[model samples]
Target: MYCNQPPEKPGNKKELLEKITNMARANSLWVTAYGTGCGAIELRPLHTSRFDMERFGIAMRPTPRQADVLIISGYLATKTLKRVIRVYEQMQDPKYIVALGSCTINGGMYFDSYNTLNVLDKYLPVDVYVMGCMPRPEAIIDGFSLLMQKIKDGRAQGWKHYKENLDYYRENQKKIITDWDLPDYNW
Candidate 1:
């Protein structure tokens, strides 16, 4: 039973601007969804009124450029990894990734498949990983809540890690993607 309570006001005497910026960032997370596998089925229920994800400030965006969060809802095949990297690069600064499903975490049932990526974090920084064969809509909501809390606390700095370690991520990516010809990042 994970609690989805809103983050408490920080009592730390931090800069007002930074606090406000994080508040805004945490409040409005535009998601770029890559519903690639079984988790896709689970993600759809979020859009319907039953889950009602919008009240929590999580909404879907069609393009990565317009989104702040990338939800990778399934396993990463070698081919899918390329597109995921491309999309991650296109997103704005201070972005975050919320990976769902055990497959995306450790290849799950696809661990034996040579084309399946065993560990997603090897290629890109993953901020939140919701475990389970297919995390239920409630669990996905809990994941988003966790991410929001991280953002508000300034703990969700995976984007910074990715930027500082771009070469490392790229190297790992290239090891699997043989015919790599992705464009340079817009940074």
Candidate 2:
């Protein structure tokens, strides 16, 4: 249920500049290479000739600080969830989260598990949920395209929402993460 239309053009110079900035951000997406579960396997083929994600301006980043998107692939264990939150917070503004697989949406096969999170949106605002047990590279690409469209339409504001509603998100995160030891986001 995300907006797909390009934003309405404004008359002012600031608005015009913002439109251009949004377009640029939409086109260039640097995804962090952090996969939490079995879905990580499918992500590898995206770089191959058949998939070639780079053609769409999607590249893998080594660190969260340099990445624009964090693709949480598969079920998130409680231990890994803590690190994921840390990495996610380190990313700069306009960041996005792509939940790959049914696990992220509803915990998939691990829905009843004690350690896995039942819903990802409670802790992190997910921009796109690439459905399937392990979504194919094509689906992942489609998800990326959708995310890009969201960026262009100014609908991908998960990071901003996180910042504004930090306490609400933190409460959800703390409920699942028992051994919380991460530093507060002061930026």
- Candidate models: Cα lDDT each: 0.86, 0.87
Checking candidate 1 for backbone clashes, the offending pairs are none
Consecutive 10-residue window with the lowest summed lDDT within model 2: 1-10
The top-ranked prediction according to lDDT is 2
Weakest ten-residue segment in model 1 by summed lDDT: 1-10
Candidate 2 lDDT, 56-167, residue by residue in tens = 8889999988999998999999889888998898887779999999999998999999889989999999999999989998999999999999999988988777776777
Per-residue lDDT tens digits for candidate 1, residues 1-187, read 1112323344657567777999999999999977657788898999899998999888899999889998888888888888888888888777999999999888999999988888899998999999988999999999999999999999998988877777788899999999999887354
RMSD of each: 7.5, 5.5
- RMSD over all Cα atoms, model 1: 7.5
